[model samples]
Target: MVYHVLNGDALVSGFKATGLSGEIIVARECLIEGDLKGETLPEFLENRARFVEDEFNEARVHYYNNVVPEFEKLLNAEPGSEFNLWFGYDLFCRANMWFVLSLLSHLEGDKEVNVVYPSFRDKHDIWLEFGRATSEQLQEAFDNRINFAGRDFRLAEDLWTAYKQTDLGRLHDLSIFHSPCFPYLPEVCQAHIDRFPYKGKKGRPERVIEDILKKNGRDFKTVFREFSAREGIYGFGDDQVRKIYDKVMKERNP
Candidate 1:
């Protein structure tokens, strides 16, 4: 599995292998461990959380040193995977990406800072290339820090409103369900979904997937295809997507 820290807060987690099922779990483990400002509660969870956090930080450095640089090179070349787009479109991805970018940007031109900088500079450059200015702009808008709840609230609300206006959001819900990791995926996706009202109903986890698919003219494959096409420069292959999907399923079911 590979993980990319977007700004300084969130991590965009992915893998290189096909049908590898552990990225999401790893991501969740990292989140629980990092505690992002020590927000995670329950005193007993702290020890386990610290262990996870340590592991996540180690993996992150390892990925930056070895895997991420290579992936960045691929993204710079032609026929790259749409991984960047996948992250750009997803709320979680954007939040994570932006936070990481912001942090690195602040650390810019400073060799003394003890932070891992992505091999690919201007990590948010792809956002500009794709015309998804909101997230890119938001990254600039916020102080180069994670502050998920603080800065992410406005961004999340905006994305939820926009997604609710389109058929694609529903479709995403279906793809989430087909995965073996539906349990975990739904928890994350639904947290965002429930924040808004769609068709006079507050979105529920149990029915979100079916509800999305049932909506007229909603096509998950097509949206994914378009997303893939736009993000071709990022070199996110089918294998990576399948890996993330499988991993989420296992974690959810397990």
Candidate 2:
């Protein structure tokens, strides 16, 4: 049986409209933005559930109900199954995709894994393409999925470890060995590193938000559009940028 593991729910409708034959699994947790304080699978999931509850005010029960099962499937699927990974070329998608790979790495089997990219017309609009893909384009991508080799899974496993640990030095070292498995590993690494508070408790996103507000005058639409256009690397939607913008403004005014 074939399984489609999507990065988030936004792409689910588009995927289904393509008439693809597979069980669709949505990654509901924002793994990149939370503290992963567990090593074992069960432990890791519980930790994430707690993080989601405290960070987003979403109940832990919701996490267990919505997020845990899909991940468990990814972790405990039978050997020799086929999986098509549907993720974008952004840090948000990379984090989810890498975590999925890390789980698959623990399973020993002839698991056939493939990555399906968006049919993007412009290089700069990659992050936007997946969310806006047509059924025909989605089908085209699925028809031309890139199969992952054994080494690719190994690399993904290593990167996931370093990513959760936030080991900048190790990530820089690993970034040198580029692979098709990770389309933009080095670039994503740089973007990830840049998110940390580089100056006065303001990360790149926070700082950029500050700059946007100053130039565009407190217009939410203007800021969101500028941020999305300027920083496709993060692949943040309105909700994320809104959160960051609020934090920046709060701290600035306070």
On TM-score, the leading prediction is: 2
TM-score of 1: 0.25
lDDT of 1 at 252: 45
TM-score on alpha carbons, each prediction: 0.25, 0.94
lDDT against the true structure, per candidate, is 0.33, 0.83
Please, what are the lDDT tens digits per residue for candidate 2 over residues 121-154?
Answer: 4676777748678888888878878889888888
Q: What TM-score should be assigned to candidate 2?
A: 0.94
| Residue 9 accuracy (lDDT) in model 2 | 88
Which residue window of length 10 is worst by lDDT in model 2?
A: 120-129
Clashing pairs in 2: none
RMSD of candidate 2 to true structure, Å: 1.7
Query: Which candidate leads the pack in lDDT?
Result: 2
